[model samples]
Target: MVVLTLAFVSTTLDLTLSDHARKERGWALSWSVVRSWRALTAGTPRPRPSAPDLRTFDGLRVFCMMAVILEHVCWLASLSYVADARYSELTRRDYDAMLMTNSTLVVQIFFLMASFLLAHKILQQRRKNLPLMKTFFETILNRIVRISPSNFVVVWFVATWMERLGDGPLWKPLVGGEAAVCRRKWWTHLIYMNNVIYPDDKCLIQTWYLAADMQLYVVALLATLLLRGRRAAVPLLAGLFIFVTGINFTLACLWRLVPTFVLHRPESVLVAYGGEPSFNVLYQSPLGNASASLAGLLLAHLHHALGDAGVRIADHKVFRAVSVLCAPAALGWAALSPRLLGGGVPHPMAAAALAALERPVFVLLVTVALLGAINGVKSWWRTWLSHFGSVAPRLSFGALLLHLSLNKALLATRLQPIQLDRPHVFFQWFGVGVLSYSAAIPLALLVEFPTQRLYKEVTELINKYKQPTQDIKMDT
Candidate 1:
């Protein structure tokens, strides 16, 4: 109920702000609604530090995390009909479409922002004399430790439960059927190589994002190593961006010419297409995601070079205002361009144009939002958002692992009917929300927490084992 209400209210406020007549009133009402919503949902603001710096980058991270959570919540609510028959009558395509689009866009924004922040951190660490290769391995290892442990627990639970529920034989082929692929590839998931094989595949739901992120990190790390310091970084990144953009445009053209390239394989198409050419471009394509990471690294380099002065100028009021306005406008363009090109049967030229427009527009919007959020406006609301951003788990990788399993679990148990057919949809959504949250939290605490600890321990032990050999060589 809380998630649905907040989503509805926030969306309503967003719509109202778009209307000139309602602008002023809407702004006021929106804040008021947010205050009430927070009170109802979280119940008592977390004790905060006075004059908290409200780290903008952290705030953006939190936003991404929450956006993903909300996206999952919306998805679960939408799927409530799978478990229970009552929800069948209540399902609405339009509502589901809206939820899916909004969730997808939000997740994209999160990825873009994350890429930028991570790149900046990586560059900074390199400057501090950290071995780039060592840093890269550590980074990937850390991510695995942080994400995989909790995730594995969830997977085990869901898989075991499904077996009990009689969904199918425990070991089926891992890559086909509606839910069959996930069942089969359970081991592939454990190793985190799912993205390499089928980058855009969503059979295991959110797991696709985890695989994509890992692949992009590897690519970005390699590019950074080859490019070296600040001098080579910009051109290398820029060239790579252009190359990826071209590839995407070409793919989009192919998609248009041979609709079969996309339509024939719906699952593969969504996974592979990603508004770009090449199979699995969206999921496994280094261009789309790596560019954002590179952009972020550039920003971080600029910050180090220019110090606060540089950051201040970039975050100047005028620059932020412009970015804020432009970001949404760019996103709006990307979203509506397909329709403007003509919905049903677009001309080849029009389709190509639309496809070409998508990559740049998405990149621009994401870049601007990152800049603005990092150094735009500060207010109580922004502060609150920053808090959530700080506290939300860096467990997206883990969350992705668990999401599909949980969805299947819910489906097998027939729990969705309660939400689907209830007289008050919000109430039903609340119940499912509780169930999902209950399931996720424990897994997070028990499995994820210990796995991260073990990762650290293992790393330390390896370092100790290697140190004595170095000492012996020195004595020699």
Candidate 2:
């Protein structure tokens, strides 16, 4: 209620601003629903080298988000009372089930991307001679402002109105159960400690990624500052990656945990596995996942250090061939290795090694692909991604917040058990993807963009006041 009301009032004020006032407050006009909608729907053209846009990631992020929703869709379907009791189990035993089992690792791409963009932005800002401390504080503030409004709206909606929205045999347990958790532990989310503090009972369980990302962001930022312009930076990142990987390996071995989710677990057990000790202690831990963040920071520095020469190397025929083969191979190995390791059988040492290397290998491949994209590698894939670059990136964050809730609502509203099959699951995913992105539009335009604009305006006003003498001198 509060979020919607504020969005409405802000939109009205922005739209009603007179031409003269609008001209004077041009940047502030970003609070306008009209402009925000345009930005959220437009397709941006490819930019020249000088453009600041990371267009490659726009489609990548949006697609990755959609995939996450699909994963949940599959998981939820498996959890629900399906017509065929054996469907979920049979499907998981199939060789192709590796995709679903390993899909969780797709999130590593996001961790890498977030840190990569942050490091890149900080490096660029540093070139303007800004104080490092100011940049650090501003970065933190900006991230909070960008992420919080949509997040708050989501959390608030779940805790308050979600149960009222739908009901069925499964509604209370599926949707209301989560809402109950949200109401009790919403404060953990506000502090970005939900993942660490309450490993098993997260309100929006998918947001464990956000908590891990936030924690890693702070650590990565501090490391960036300490090692800025230092030659030892790469070595330190390498060491961190190894250290994090070792922790994952050690914990997986000690806990006798699988490298990834054991695909062949009973459908009932699989659904409840999220709260299992393995996931809480190791799987979602920032320490276990820090390698991806470090990888991102390393990639950003390497890109900045390499410049155009790196682009030439990426474009080389030999290098391109090797990359083409190597990247997919790495992903394939990460996807299939756990299943090949006896499907979480009593091979603790082997499972431990797989757990340790699975994400790192995937992150390595993603880093290579990102490097290629950043260097403007020509491909049909890159071209398709660029087409949606303008709008999707803006909505990706909102979609992340809203998709899970939306999916649960969709499932809970069903009057009967769904048929569980690949085609049915795919159909459900298509609907969820369309609806999730559609729902995200309002959240982004109303809550996320407006909050960001308001924050920027307030910061600029503060800076203006702080430099009053400079402004007066300029006027003179």
Candidate 3:
């Protein structure tokens, strides 16, 4: 409450301050907290540079985040002593259940976009003859700066104060239990290794994605650096895809792991998948999840390569047709994912094949779709996604961090078991989405944006101080 109050006060002050006053004061760390709200509340779109317009990604990410939120709502509903105890089991037998089950694929889009943008940025830097080592360090620094402060604050809040919000029969075990584990194991999250070290004992289990992503980021950067030239890049990326595919296939077969988290799981394990070996071995492993990131890197390399050669994909009818066809194919694949794996019990070969191909195939199709959209594939769907999906992405990361907790809090406060139906689950999702995004606004304004602004200010000051030394050296 105190933190939220401070954020409100700072945002209010930021709104009242004039432009001149802001320019004079914005550099101060304290004032950056206030000035951050200007961007948050701004009506204008941020200007784009010569780089590819990724506003489309903003929409993609926001949509994925909402889908994940809806999944969590359904998950929590399944966990509850629901009025309709059989709903989870029966729902899985339907076609629409595939939508919820395969929605986990949306997470890969984030992984894909991360590597794609990283490759794109590095390619641009290479054109300007930037130092690879310097760019590498800067990338690490910027990622940490962007992600850590808000993450730390959220972790601390969950650990210390979340249980204080409310209490019920399940509050202690569901809410307080998590907080207690966080009190002891929070360092794993801060270091971004909890996914590897104790895959099950998590402060916020959903955050395993962060650990996987950070680990993959380092691996991708290192690979990009070592295999710097175009000659080495092709074999390196292709070999990486084959290598990761083999690992996923081998692990799935050896461990008999489920291909995806939502598939082949009993109704009892719906909520957290707490004791599921598949969750530990396949779901959280960086290597297991590398296909999407690899797909992103591959697409990015091609994008830059095409741009350098003055080739527009849209100009080629064949390429455009293939790209346009990917959208429906991807949708159909997702919708029938359960059937693809043989929903109840699959043959060993089929399960292994699904593990090997699931992410790569889906990611490839989605990457193609993304390529089309970016390269001027016009459609009403793309138009809607671009416009409506842009702004919410600003809050998407914060919402991701907080949504599960909000869902848990809501359920923890419930005195009666929820009626597990589509309508009720939708209502839960709606309420949780509002609460999560509402909480995220203050979180972003307070911690995330201010930290970014302060980091930029500090870097600028250091750069200014170094300029004279560089000039003097040049003169000498």
Candidate 4:
């Protein structure tokens, strides 16, 4: 009788345990499905990977962010400061300052940042033997979802409400026209093809950077796949550099396009692209802007290699010398750039040389300097700036999306012109930057931050399930 009772109790426990296991699995699956649906419909899975921070790079970002705001301040001030004067007519100092402001080069820094971060993460994943195709798909999706929501906020507001906000001389051309263009071509901005779809000032004029970034991101995925395990990284990089630079050079010469940023174009370059100064299709396209990103890819490889080898190139005199020289080189090129292009189209060879060398040159120089910082050499000011920069991981993208809208609103509402060349101009720019940043914070916290968090959570849940599959050896 006792033995019989023992057997029955054992059987009961077994059934209960089995039942519990089944229920657990079902619950997990259901939860995963719900998360997936929510992520797909209402949010996206955010990814937060554990990676070392390159602080100087962070500092560089801070500097660049402010530089962009300052550039626009001067630009807008030039337009509004002299209420009755044409912007085309400029004083000697204004002209010289305009020619020398290389602030727009900071845009290239954005592409470099994106490329470096993504490439670094991709190579790290590859080391864990993650499926390349799956990773490639996820990376692209992640990028799109990450950038889209915040982008849509700005795009939607511009199209629907900005024109109604205010009116000035700059109002109709800048606001009303932009609203019309965006309302009509919002899809292009949604997909990051605004630069290609609508060439002129319709929609967010500054979003060409975003468009170029997304397009180049796709290209990077393909490149990452091709260079898996670093097998083809070198040759692939070489070919990409040669091809992208060669093509840009060929086209610049063909179109007689100048190499300066839109804000500081040489007169001849202006006529070449029909007076729309800035990176139009010929310069702003993914094809033209890709060399900077490719250089970033190469830098990523070098960064990984240095980590594995545990060596600091900055310790070597020759390498240190090269890194030190980068600053002066960049400054020198920027100052002389206006002279290089002259008033009209430069000599064909000169134009070709500037176009071919411009991107890769700065990228290489910047990488070298960045490499030094990564290896633990940093100035005190750099350290401080980096600390400040690290505090706002989401700020840059937020500012990029928000600043233009803010600028449009401010420029449109002004009853009088902004004073462009006054001694207090620097303070005015500082104020504008503060306002831009302040506006960006809410967007970052509410829209950008939440979306990123949702993405990370869903991704983690999905990966948790994927682990078991990953652990099982597949038949290759």
What local distance difference test score does each model get?
Answer: 0.49, 0.76, 0.77, 0.65
lDDT of 2 at 357: 76
Q: Highest lDDT: give the candidate number.
A: 3
**Candidate 2 per-residue lDDT over residues 1-476, each given as its tens digit:** 66566656656766888889876675566567876776667767756775333676888787788778777887777666788877665666565566765777878989998999888877655556667788788778888887877887799889999999878877998899889999999999998999988676768888888889989998888778776666677778888888888887787778766556552255434455555666776567888788899999998877766662344646588656655565566557655776657743547677666767788888887877677767666666666766674666777887788888888888887888889778987899889888888888888887787777778777777777879888889999
| Cα deviation of 416, candidate 3, in Å | 1.7
TM-score of each: 0.67, 0.92, 0.92, 0.79
RMSD of 3: 2.7
RMSD (Å) per prediction: 14.0, 2.8, 2.7, 11.0
In the range 181-211, model 3's lDDT, one tens digit per residue, is 8898999988999898866686887899998
Clashing pairs in 3: none
Task: For residues 368-406, write the lDDT of model 4, one tens digit per residue.
Answer: 666665555444543565665344444666776767667
Off by over 4 Å in 2: 1-8, 23-31, 42-45, 50-53, 263-271, 308-311, 343-346, 469-476
Ranking by lDDT: 3, 2, 4, 1
Model 4's alpha-carbon lDDT is: 0.65
* lDDT score, candidate 4, position 161: 84
